[model samples]
Target: MPIMFGRTIKRPPWRQCKVGSRDDLQVGQALNNKVMELQEQDFNFTIDTAFTKEIRVERLPKGFKMPTIEQYGGTIDPEAHLESFKFVMLFRGASRRHHVPSIPLYLEGLAKSTEWFECLKPRSVSSFVQLGRAFIANFMSSRVDRKIMANLLAIRQRSNETLRAFLTRLNSEALKVWDLDPIVKFQALRSGIRDVELKKSMIMDEPADMHNLFSRCEKHINLVEVLAAKQEKEREPEKKN
Candidate 1:
């Protein structure tokens, strides 16, 4: 028995073989046979004590359940999938080491079979950030049409859409356009309004900035809600009669 890392490793049977007075050729043959036998046997052992002490493994809390992430295939928007994956990982309090390795488990279809092979290479992807970038690059064409300034400028409040809903839609579109200019945003805000009074008010006295613009919009939004409620209350009596 050999003591290793405070554990006993049983010596292989080859170590106990004795060499009698055999000829030189016979001795070499016997030695070669023993070497081959040693190579064929399995030696199961733990890591060195020093290495085991240096690294700490994190465990999930007892009875904790992992949320199921939607599987990403190459056909869908890669950025959206990546964002959702990141959100779930953050919620779970996953570590950086867990990030890169764990993302592969959620991938399937073309994403797992093809894009994954192209994106991850031993030397190429070391971290989750790098993997995300590579993944997006590989599936960039699958993403929906990228929003531009023209798209923002073309936004219009629909006839039935409330001012609050219109503003919410506008804001969502605005977020998709990268490095948006404040002037362009203000112009979009002004152009998208359908209400005659609100449009006239905005044109007569242009907002100083986005803050002022939203403040004006907020007042109108609240006023519209109040007037609508009052009208509904008045109509109730007529309906009852």
Candidate 2:
């Protein structure tokens, strides 16, 4: 049976892709139409569209975890073999859709690509281990260690923004570069690694510290702004001596 299964996404992402003005006229109209279609029962689009072959997903880090139907909280395909699906999705671009939230997008792909799902077989544990080894070897072979280091340290150019803004901007860039160079995609994976690390620390650390790290960045920024304003005021003398 085609293991591919997922739902439609007509909302949740509206905020992320909100229409602003004439600046984004075409894309905005498209998004608006998608929302309206889903809202109006006329929408026949399925959110997921990935052709799945039984592939194995490596042990997913906690945050990269997808939803399963069994989870009362969200969907998780214990049978999902996420790594395989993820690799294919990355290798062969998925059928594009908008408004689908993070994990659900994945499920939508499965739901949409029943034929693709039919061809896949669950990978063996040994084969997966070999693939991991091969992956490291292949990755390392492409360039010497120094180049890898250079790529690792090279940060993308983007202005400072809140976490939400950062994600939106990051997603836009990711879509842009997804095909031109896999490096762009690789960079995104690295960011996911960063996110997973933060989550790990937050879950393990004391609540106060977690809050401090998340909230402190902005708070410190505000404090700097306040202090700078105060300094500027001092430089300007009042009319009365």
Candidate 3:
């Protein structure tokens, strides 16, 4: 206490306080803990808000079962995976909004796809079509041994192969060739036939288009089958004797 103007005045408690006191240290610790708690709360709120905004969930039709699609691991063909994804989504009656956001759920083990999706700016992907194009562009290198026009032309009918089997193989090969010309496909089929009589017929008649060519091939295919059945029937009599 000090005398001021003949009146006794008590010193303030703060002025008498000492540094490194146990109570001071305890108060400091309490303040630090409270600040950390507030920071953690803010962090959690930010994460929840961002997640809610990013993913838009839609209610599916009652009792409609969702189809299971294989997860893409970035090592396989991206285009094929995307096609499969779209097919299942379409089958499930999912709209464009469902497609754009649901892609991340199907992706796994692919940093390029999963991480890339996470880093994308909000609202950058507008539709499924845009998302598909971007996905293919990113993973195009993973596709192996893509077919070319020459692969279609190189297809040949085997010596022992039936006309029907040969035609099926040729058609399958043609489907794999991208942007194939109709005339080229017609000529390739004409040249690849193994049967001498059928090849002669095709060369002599020179079918107008692919449809006409297939019609001519179908006649030969039927004749071959009929002859095969007749030969087998004859062999049955020899076995009996």
**Residue 17, model 3: Cα distance from true site in angstroms:** 22
On residues 56-120, what C-alpha lDDT tens digit does candidate 1 reach at each position? 24345465556699888778888888888888877887755456556667888877764344323
Q: Could you tell me every candidate's TM-score relative to the true structure?
A: 0.52, 0.22, 0.54
Candidate 2 has its poorest 10 consecutive residues by lDDT at: 95-104
In model 3, where do residues sit more than 4 Å from their true spots?
1-65, 111-113, 118-122, 158-165, 179-184, 200-222, 225-241
**Model 1: CA > 4 A from native:** 1-65, 118-120, 154-172, 178-187, 194-196, 200-241
lDDT of each: 0.73, 0.39, 0.72
Point to the candidate with the largest TM-score.
3
Residue 40 in candidate 1 has what lDDT? 41
Per lDDT, what order, best first?
A: 1, 3, 2
Tell how far residue 202 is off in model 1, in angstroms. Answer: 4.4
**Model 3 lDDT vs. the true structure?**
0.72
